[model samples]
Target: MAISDVPPADCPPWLVPVHTLLLGIGVLCWDATYILMTRRALATKSYGMPLLALAVNLSWEMVYVFYVCEAVLETTGFFVWLLLDIGLVYTTIRFGPHDWKDSSPWVGRNIGCILGLLTAVGCVGHYTFAVWWLAEPGRGIGGDKRGKWWQGREGLDTTELAFWSAGLSQLNLSAGSVAMLLVRGHSGGTGYAIWFFRTMGTLFGLILDNAFMWWYWPAGYGFIVSPFAVFIWGTSMACDIVYPFLLWQVRRTELLLPDGRLVRCDSQPASTASSDHGKKKR
Candidate 1:
C-alpha cells in the first residue's frame, strides 16, 4: 500500500473524533498516576505485585506510542509489535513473582523465557520478511491482488508466534491468580482486589485478541475488516489503561511489617506443626 493509503501524517482523518478524545483522556490519567506513584516517598519501598502491573501498563504504552507515530507504524508496525512482545516478556521476567518460593515464580519465569525466545525468533523472521517484501513487493504467497507486501506473510508468522507467547503469558497470569486466591487470607485485601482486576482485565484482553487473530485467519482479513481492527486496537489500549490504575491502587494500600519492612507472603500451604501451634495459641 502506498503511504497515502494511511491516514494523514498530521492526524489520521479516518480516526473518529471520539477515539482521539478517549485516548487523550486515558493517556492523561495514566501519565499523571504513574508520575505520582513513582515520585511518592514510598516508591523506594517494595510495591509487591503492583510493580508487575505497572510494567505491563508501560509495555502497552510503548505499543500505543508506536501505533500513533505514522512513520513508525507505516515502516515497521509488525516489528514494533514484536519488539513490544519482547518488552512484555522482559517485564514479566523482572517483576512477575512476589517471592522466590512461590509456585508462580517458577511458572512465570519459565513462561517469560519461552516468550523471550519466541519474540527473538519473530524479530528475525519479520526482518527477513521485510527485506524480501522490499525486494519483490508484487510477489505473493497466494494469487491475491493485494500483493505480497500487504499480505504480511512474514508478519503473520510473527503474529502466530506472538499468539502462543500471549497464550503462555495468560497461563502464567492464571497461575498467579490462583496462588493469590489460595493465599487471600494472608494478603492485604487491597492486594487481592488488585490481582482480581488485573487478571480479569488481562483475561478479557487475551480472549478478545484471540478472537481477532482467529477472525483474520484462512486468508487474513484485518485489512478488510475495519471494525475488527478497531476492536482489537481499542481493546489493547484499554488493557494499557486498566493495568496501571490497578497497580497504583495496589501500591497505595500495601501492608508493612512490624519493623517497617515490607512483608512478602508465600502461597505454600502451612505445615501441620505451624497449624498446631496456631491452634494452641488461639
Candidate 2:
C-alpha cells in the first residue's frame, strides 16, 4: 500500500504484497465464516461434519509459513493466517463430534484421534509434493550436505509447487462449499458471503501468481515448466469461473435455518423452520 513497497518496472514488486495481503484477508474471511457456522452448530447441537478443509488448509499454511514464503509481507501474512487456521481447527474440534455420535460412537467419543490422524496425513501429503521441503539444503534435517534427496526432484519448482497445494485447496473449497450447502441445508455454518470472499481471494491470487508472473518472471527467473504452477493456475481459473454461478444457485435456492433446514423465505417464518427440524428429529 505504501510507495516504498512498490517493486521495479521489469518486475512486479507490488504483486508480492498484493498476493500476501489477499491471502491473509481470504484466510480470515474463510475462518470467520466457519466461526459463525460453528457457533450455530454448537448452539443447535445438531450435526457436525468432517474436517477435510480445516486439515488441508492448516497444512498448506504451515508449509508456506515455515518453508515456502519468507518475505516480510508474505511471511507475516502466512503467520497470521496460520494462527487463524488454529482457531478454525479449534472450532472444528469443538463442534464436529455430533455428526457421528450416534452413527459412530467410537469416533464421536474420541474425535481428537481423527484429528491427529488427519494431521499426520496432511503433513505427509503436503511434504510429498512440496519442492523446497525436499530440496532445500540444511532446511529439512540438521545434518545434510547434499540437498537433493530424491531422484527427479532436484530441480523442483518451488513457486508452482506451493500453488499446487494452494490451487487444489481453492478448488476443494469451491466444490466442498457447494456440497456443504446441500448437507447443511439451512444449517447456518456457512453463507454465500463466504464464497464471495473465497472467489475474490482466488482472483487476487491469480493476478499475482499467474498473470504478473507470466508477464514478469519470464525475463528474470526464466520460464520453468512447473507442473505445480500450471496445475494450480489452471485449477484457480477453473474454480473462479464456476464460483459466480454457484453463488447464484445458493442465493436462488430455498432459505436455510441456523440448523441447516430448508424454509421458504417468503412464506414460512423462522419458527416454521424450527418446527420442521423438530419434526425431523422425531
lDDT of 1 by residue, 39-78 (tens): 3213323223232332333343343233322334333543
- Clashing residue pairs, backbone N/CA/C < 3 A, model 2: 37-189, 186-256, 186-257, 186-260, 187-259, 187-260
Q: What is the lDDT of candidate 2?
A: 0.52
Listed in order, each prediction's TM-score against the native is 0.35, 0.62
lDDT of 2 at 121: 87
Q: In TM-score terms, which candidate is top?
A: 2
Clash number by candidate, in order:
0, 6
Off by over 4 Å in 1: 1-15, 32-98, 104-255, 259-282
Which candidate leads the pack in lDDT? 2
What is the lDDT of every predicted structure here? Answer: 0.36, 0.52
Candidate 1, position 109, lDDT? 51
